[model samples]
Target: MSDRPMTTTPPRPPAGGGLFGRGPFAGAGMLVEKSMSFWPSTRRLMRRLAPERARITVVLVLALIGVVLSVIGPRLLGWATDMIFDGVIGKQLPSGITKEQAVAAARAAGDDSFADMLSRMDVVPGRGVDFGALGTLVVWAVVLYVATSVFAWLQGYILNDVVQRTVYRLRSDVEDKLNRLPLRFFDGQPRGELLSRVTNDIDNVSQTLQQTMSQLLTSLLTVIGVLAMMFVISPLLALIALVTIPLSMVVTKQVAKRSQKLFVAQWTHTGTLNAHIEEAFTGHELVKVFGRRPEVEQAFQDRNEELFKASFGAQFISGIIMPTMTFIGNLNYVAIAVVGSIRVATGTMSLGDVQAFVQYSQQFTQPLTRVASMANLLQSGVASAERVFELLDAEEQEPDPADPVPPASRRGRVEFEHVSFRYEPEQPLIEDLSLVAEPGHTVAIVGPTGAGKTTLVNLILRFYELDSGRITLDGVDVTAMRREDLRSHIGMVLQDTWLFGGTIRENIAYGNPRATEEEILAAAQATFVDRFVRTLPDGYDTVIDEEGGNVSAGEKQLLTIARAFLSDPSLLILDEATSSVDTRTEVLVQHAMAALRSDRTSFVIAHRLSTIRDADLILVMDAGRIVEHGTHDELLAAQGAYHRLYAAQFSGALVTDDDEVSGEEEVAGVRG
Candidate 1:
């Protein structure tokens, strides 16, 4: 049987309608769109930067300086334009005439408009342009632009550093959170969903901050600086440009409201699809065995299609903001241009001022467009942030006691007193179950499926806390002792063998990291692992693949036994450790387990009755209750639950004086 706890079930997808009231798997309640607290999530994300406040302040100052310099450039160029225009007009007039005399002459000729325009010009009559002054203004503008670029670059560099550091800390917190969470928490969550939060979602958050932070800051600063410059040049044109501000806000608000939901849907579908793919690949063999390829492919296609729709909708909706803002800005630009020209012709404003206002108009609208564009990115980023925050905010397991009971010595006596546990509240699986294993004795537990055998062992390891009652180890309450201390004295070997991607020597030594080479070799030899290691090309140095497929099933079991042997644990758990191996291999495994179990309290959970015939005590459990318990011979003599189970295994062979030898022969036949 699979080692997964009988009470554990696969997580079901959340239920609701999609953003459009329809989507792939809508009937199954998949791809449901969740409303997000955008501002709250965004604010929380910003708070993560609190540690870098000083550096952020420096970045802000740099950006301000850059904006100030950039805003001054167009004004300086406008002054140069006025100088050139005035010089051309003044050179057409006679020499030795003052600018006031030239304007009076135009007034006397009844050209009031021309006279007013000349009054606005800074012309010296009959004097050519001051090339030196023009050169100075042009040079100043160039210097200001270069300085602006430098400051912008500097701030960008600093902000990038801040974002990277913040993300690093966030990743560390997430990893720590995963470690502190209880096993039950993981049991309910899909592996793919958790992985997405840790890897994909966090990565998206980093990219969003990296791409949007600098650009958003710069755009906002430009809007402020350029607006001020626009008013300074011509308040009339400035007012015209400001007309579009409300319209732009309305557009952004409408588009963002819809796009935010779509973005949330996009990422939600992304996680769901990832979960399906991970589940399918991890169980690829099972899928093929059951001929579920078409069903799996169809599910993948449905989720993939939903994701595409969500992504396209998000991008398409947010994409409308730029063009719409550009249209409104173009109208504002036309209004500014026509009004500024009239003001210039009427001498109310200079041509230079009109030119400056036009440049400011473009500068103003460009930033607004950029701000709108960044809205989509911000929405997606915050969506990911909310997911990560959800993970971090999950309820953690009860912390270890401040003052734990110290285990100065371990004798491996284990006792369960009135223990009660249930995976779900309303459905009780184990109630008031009690058992005791004396020191240096083998207690075998035999049960059918769903009989709570795995859960019992899990409780011993503190993998799950009891709903009631206490467990004691060596006369000390297990809860009072630190989990690390309690587990340190216990070693377990499961039906499903696991080995990391490392050498055989390293896998064996994992049981005791501080074990010396000689100790490791001795444990391997005792567990029959040395016999196989010598056959391999590299002996103990042979590298195991991630799946441990390079070694046979029997070999993997031997390695695990070797690991347990190296620990020399006072308490050992073997949950059907030899069930998966061949009969020939089972003999060797039984011998290895016998060597490991000597002088240690061992809890053996098995389905095969023959394996526990020699056990000091045997427990027969049914429906989470110990239906019968005693020595194997006593239970068989009493013709209780153990006898029934044993008889069922042998096809109802009755126990008798003549049948005793045949029973032994039957056991041997079953093993072979």
Candidate 2:
């Protein structure tokens, strides 16, 4: 098997906005730069890896050993060279030593049978290399290299385990956090930004951990080990070796300071570009229908140009660090050479000692150059980690009640009492509102734009917390119950349908994992989905492509209804559920919905007055207050907000607060 290590990446989301920040799933803008604290993000990330502390420690130990062994090899070579020089002087040999002389010398030294010594000795000088010492040093050097390789492999094996585990846990945490985050968090935030955080940001951290971070540890160990060895060889020369560090640091620090902002801007621009691409691709159909292709392209081009500038700036600035440090390292090498030559001439230092010091100096400067190279990875990783950590650390849903109230039968008697809320602290949307939805009652909430219709159900689902009041299901406060339990008692179908990429059977079964075939087929038949499913070549087994692209919008809506039917929820929320179907399909679906609504409390948020005409109670909302509350006939007789809304819609005129009916119908709204 190949020696490549395993890694984890998120599953690809389905097309047409299956993930975040695309088309129908769009969220807030993410083009602006974010100010992130690096050390805090780094600390939080390290803490997340605490569970793998033992493995990390082992990897670190191996790195230290490898670095020490690597440093020792050069010093050993220098020692062996010095030994060869000493032998040359002692023998007073010719400039070219032959095999005959090497053999004769070896025999005379006390071993008459030791042959092949000539091959091991260096013949550049009159006396060849000290065969014994040179051969021993060469053998030991190879051994150290082999041992270093093994340790490096082991380090990689263990470190990869730690990094992947950390990534796995972090990804799981992000997923859980997304679920726990309040709806307002999503409503006000850009989905693309969140998508970038979960994907790009995490990948950056993973790449750094897998590759550059290990290199960083080794480089650090090398610097320390080489420094100590240099001092051991010659304190004066070692001090000369130290000259490169401050110069390198000053250069690296200056470049890094400018580069940090550039890197942050680079990722921010990347997210922005991705956001636009996602939006454009998902909404390409709308763009064409509205003749907005040029506008969309211009917007995309603007974001792309911004991204290019950021990327180029980040890379150009960081790219200078390597060559700059390399030049400074060369200067240090020259200083060491000059100082050591004088020391050697004065007989204060041996040729071998000077040679070893030179080697150690190179060893020292090599890491400094590497430190500069890895700085880019370090900055990029920290920037990305900060984003990932932000999502992980975001405020979660209000904590579930301790010892939550026991599960009780759901009568679906929902009540909103004196509920006051604002997505923003300064802008209140709902205030002092009180409403009781009786069991088996159909309550239709109609409102002008920004009237907080959907926000009401969001509160009921415990997706957001009420600032000052209680929402209850059968007298049990929803907030007092577990979110999962509260959600289990409710099912929702919105105007926008989201169908996963799967077979028809699987998509329907998503609503009821343990549902039987008979029940599934029954639900399908009840929602009139079986009428179309039976006509398909694969029937229930037909696979829906990503975003259910294979199916018509009306068919997708029917499937959702069928899914809801399969769940048999105690309470149902419909936000214009039939708005996607044709007139004939709508009539049939309405018949199915009428059946599904019986004996179950249902809330319908609608704009079309005709759809909710039969609603048992209609609450006409204006601003944040209910201006009219009664049945269709009653409200029509009252000539109130509901009456005005119905009059405009019934006459195919645009609605206004003044209730004037002009012939022009330019203002866009949901049927009304």
Lowest lDDT block of 10, candidate 1: 1-10
**Candidate 2 per-residue lDDT over residues 444-478, each given as its tens digit:** 99987677787788789887788898888988988
What TM-score do all the candidates reach, one by one? 0.90, 0.86
Q: Which whole-number lDDT from 0 to 100 does residue 373 have in model 2?
A: 83
C-alpha local distance difference test of each model: 0.84, 0.79
Off by over 4 Å in 1: 1-33, 539-541, 650-672
**Residue 390 CA displacement from its true place in model 2, Å:** 2.6
Name the lDDT of candidate 2: 0.79
Residue 342, model 1: Cα distance from true site in angstroms: 1.6
Candidate 1 local lDDT, 111-191, one digit each (tens): 999899999998888898999999999999999999999998999899999999999999999999998898888765656
C-alpha lDDT (0 to 100) for residue 620 of candidate 2: 79
